[model samples]
Target: MGFPVIRNRRLRGSAAVRNLVRETQLTVHDLIYPLFAVPGTGIKHEIPSMPGVFHLSLDLLDAELDEIVKLGIQGVLLFGVPEHKDETGTSACHDHGIVQEATRHIKKRYPQLLVIADTCLCQFTSHGHCGVVKFNDALQQAEVANDESLELLAETAVSQARAGADIIAPSNMMDGFVHAIRTALDEAGYTHVPIMSYSVKYASAFYGPFRDAAHSAPQFGDRRTYQMDPANAREALREAEADVIEGADFLMVKPALAYMDIIRTLKEHFDLPVVAYNVSAEYSMVKAAAANGWINEKSIVLEMLTGMKRAGADIILTYFAKDVARWLRDTE
Candidate 1:
């Protein structure tokens, strides 16, 4: 009944004891790897900011998929950087776009792998804004046009669905995105495909490395206009309500490390599966610290991932998925 009588250390005593009493366990099945696809052959350029991640071309993507299969990673989130970008991000909806090509190839090679296409226009837009931008001449400012962006998002979603994308993740954070994309997918005979909405994504600084990996950084203004403000908690729930009402199959909280509270909030409030994106900046920091001998990379990474799982994340999209999978296998 007392602290001395009930020894908590008994559960934390050793590996076996700790394993038996572990409240959260992160497995390869719960991990989703993010892969960048560029338009080229035999290309696997390492992202400078993200140490172990690469910008893989379609030709080279299969080899990476081979290793992911071996590691038992069940899901992969793919982002495409096309050779051509435009005002409306036309490349994103192209019939033979980079992501479409890569998705077709990936599904051909690994039929069972859950390949998720990141449906957004930042990388494909020359202006590098998530949505359609219009200048407010009187106000001396540019604003993202939410309604116009929805049409483009719908086009992009349908195209990805056509290319064998098992899941379409709309990360643009535009209003009515889930509804538009869902309607488009259904009209295009992809009603079976699911939508993974980046329901509670915030305009956080933890996305620095991801912009580099996806080539999606804005040329001028930041994403504060479209992405949720980092200071708001109640707004995230409102966003979730909209997405859920629009029929989002999976709800996600981006930049998971600093927003575990938001993750828990969404998980508690929604019946849909909750996804936590351990964004690139978070991964890069751990890699940098581990490289400098400041921390044990394996132990820290496991702890961080387990923390997300404990916070009610059903799946985590991280750059460290491959490494974590290998670590999990070896430790077993």
Candidate 2:
């Protein structure tokens, strides 16, 4: 037990020794790739900000899904970009909605693939807010209608479930969203579908690339009212607790790099599978730096993913899923 006799370098002597004594492991099963779904056939448009990501139409999307299955990526988080948007985000809950149609297609073709529908109104709402918005005359700006948004959020969850989404991931951060959606899913005969709640989303600047990819930037205001403040860690626990009490099957912490502590906190306190969202801005930063030759992409990415695992994340929603999968394969 003394310092000289118990030198820790014994386990760090070689690669095989280090591997055998590794406390964390990152695998393909822990990754959930985020994909963009747009309307139109045979189209695969690249997102300008998020370099490697693309907006794939269903036809083009099918081919990618096939590759994803072959690569052994376990799940996908889908964000649909509709041709039209409205004040109420009607497209989000329509029978033939973009996400709904995409869900149906994946289930019919890749029935074994785990499809998690991004159940939020931002991409479909004309105002581009995550929920229904109403102009508040007193505040001199538009304000998201929280209670009213819950009704539509619940409807969206039910619609995605009906379309064969195995998991409904509600990322709006609206009050009572989990409970409302849980009730809606049960009433719609989708009790088997699980809810993956964005329980600890924060109002952070790290989502710019994602907003560009999803086309969900608010036209007028910010999401600070509903999303948690970035400075508060204790509040994340409160939010996670509420989602769990409301029947959320999984809890998520967004912008995972800067929030690893939050991920560990939630994992330590909750029994549900804690998920970490390796956000778009985080991805873009790495890509930008790597492109500039400031760092090594493979090593940094693997370390980042492994760090999340070491931080206690059971799953990670990341843009690096495919790259990480290929990298992991190369080492073996």
Candidate 3:
């Protein structure tokens, strides 16, 4: 099949031909929208760094949910901004916690919609670390207590499951987190609940907009101790392997745009569904360029997301979900 004899351009000659030969497809059903729920009566505050993304209150979720349902978006990943934070992140596992309340509310109204609760303590902890922090005598500074934090992470998973979250997504990046959360969920009589693990989260600068949106930036130190280093690719496989062994139902790579290779690698090596997180910074950059008229937002987003799917992401968690859904529908 030489190029001249093959005449590949024949397939690209028309929209009909292109459609027939298209190897990858992007659809509304592939999207998982991320929503932020804060504790308040009336609030729909737009995140400054991440334009168009709002911090919605429980009372205000109806509009968002209605739109999501209408858009044919299948799932929503939730993050909570509690009214209060503490050393232990007590609110993270409370029955009346912001995320729990939002989950219950969403399920009560839209029972069919998949609600995934983000099981992490960063937004709930006063120090903004994902886990419990303690003074390390050896390191001579306060450090995240991984083993101690596992209990809270497990408790958080159970709490979310109890609150009617369809899935528990643990983004803490702690060792054995999937095993801990899985054990806790099963023990709490939620054996059917699945764990979506952030298997290869990197401590990268690409998360600044997310930290701003979630208000989860560390107060004293960075998350390099727990989050994977950006320099290593093999480490991603080991991380995913551990989560797989620990019973993670889905493995996700955060900040997806720059990590498409990792996404492809995981899909090639793992049987479980691989998810790609089109993180805040990645979203904001496109929004910024689009706002400045430097790029066509729809074309760029469509191309980028299609590339992710082509890279073998089974599902994508993205802020652009709503727009992408609408775009796909309009095109159809």
Query: How close is every model to the real structure, measured as TM-score?
Result: 0.97, 0.98, 0.98
The C-alpha RMSD in Å for every predicted model, in order, reads 1.5, 1.4, 1.4
CA lDDT of each candidate? 0.92, 0.93, 0.94
Regions of model 3 farther than 4 Å from truth: 1-5
Q: Across residues 154-207, which tens digit of lDDT does each residue of candidate 2 receive?
A: 988888888899999999999999999999999989989999999999999999
lDDT of 3 by residue, 1-332 (tens): 56556668778988999999999999998999999999888999999999989999999999999999999998999999999999989899999999999999999999999999999999999999999999989879998889999999999889899999999999998888999999999999999999889999998889999999999999998999999888889999999999999999999998799899999999999999999999999999999999999999999999999999999999999999999999999989
Maximum-lDDT candidate = 3
- TM-score, predicted candidate 3 vs. hidden true structure: 0.98
Best by TM-score: 3
Model 3, C-alpha of 126: deviation from truth (Å): 0.7
* TM-score winner, 2 or 3: 3
Q: lDDT of model 2 at residue 205?
A: 95
Q: Candidates ranked by TM-score, best first?
A: 3, 2, 1
Tens-digit per-residue lDDT, 1-332, candidate 1:
56557668767888898889877878999999988889878898999999989988887887899999999999899999899988889999998999899899999999999999999999999989998889999999988999999999999899999989999999999889999999999999999999999999999999898888888889888998889899999999999999999999999998899999999999899899999999989999999999999999999999999999999999999989999999999988
- Candidate 1 stretches greater than 4 Å from native: 1-5
